[model samples]
Target: MIFEDMDRIVFAGDSVTDMGSAQPVGEGLFENLGTGYVRIIDNLLAACYPERKIRVTNSGISGNTSRDLLARFQRDVVDLKPDWVSICIGINDVWRQFDSPAIPDEQVMPEEYEQNVEQMILQVKGKVKGIFLLSPYYMEPNREDAMRSRMDEYVAVCARLAQKHGCIFVDFQQMYEDYCKIRHSTFIAWDRVHPNRVGATLMARAFLEKCEFDYNHGNGEVH
Candidate 1:
């Protein structure tokens, strides 16, 4: 429903999305799109809606902040001419605070986070059919306390930006937190941020609920 037309879909973010996907820039097959949630999404679509030739691409890079994603958005995302783009970021925005304490918050303040996302959204608005804004998150009762508060502001920014732009908002943070209540966070990702296959499956399932594609392919009835 988000992207009305069956056009190219691009997934952009950090290692969570990267998941060591093939790098289309260097070789072929379109960044492999990895075996992450993005790939899970593509796989389900291919299996069920075989007629929908929607090419899925992943431009996620490990250890990348919003700045890094924004810098290459033009080349990796825009150049693909995607009909829809899903972005999950902000972990690095907080991680840097721990790795480099001297770094000022002003550099990655919530306002700055909002600005970075807004710019990316505005740039891709007209060309793309829809945008999916995914919130960056951390594990509940994280071992790192400072990292928790720092990422909250970024998450708030994501929520606000998604609302402001009328885009689909997927709160991976809340989703994973709830998942932890039923199952160990490690059931998904050992670190709780990067996902294992089970975690990736959860994400794919969540997306499928939102995606108005198919029930079992040939049935042609919305699930």
Candidate 2:
């Protein structure tokens, strides 16, 4: 309910947000929104708030780090002139460090990651109605796990930036932490990064909770 009628929201980040969405920008009809939380949110908005007529756009790209997002922020998000924007990046920033240790350039260090995200927030802070700063997560439940621990640092960065910029913070890492306790992360994502439908649904629910969506609204009435 935070969004008003005809509000345009753009979801920007990496493959986690991308899934299989159309390149450059994805919106309107068919699978252009991809098969991720963005699509589910689009569906829920239409189903629960038929009168709002909110528009959701996907600006995520596969294999992108915060650096990549910052590079395209102006073109993919700012130029689109969205009323709201959600950014969920940084996973590849840490993943590259572990997966390809030899490539220093591919790995975006924490300081740079923070800077990139902050630049992005600054780009649209006053222009957009609001911003969603979603934390990058690793599905591993163990706090001591190397990747999970490193991911927590990035989550902390997101939290800090959200507070500094007065943006709405959606802690996807914490959301996954609680859900992973109930069911193994493997049940949600085999690779613990790219989530299947079940994981995507959980993500969509988490996002909607922050937006004050009414799950039971219009249940007995037809659209």
TM-score of 1: 0.86
Q: CA lDDT, every prediction? A: 0.76, 0.94
lDDT per residue for candidate 1 within 120-199, as digits (tens), equals 89889877778988888886645356777677778888989999998788887777777778878776677657888888
On lDDT, the candidate that comes out on top is 2
Q: Quote the lDDT for 132 in model 2.
A: 95
Q: Least accurate stretch of 10 residues (summed lDDT) in model 2?
A: 214-223
Error of 1 at 180 (Å): 0.9
Residue 162 of candidate 2: its Cα lDDT? Answer: 96
TM-score of 2: 0.97
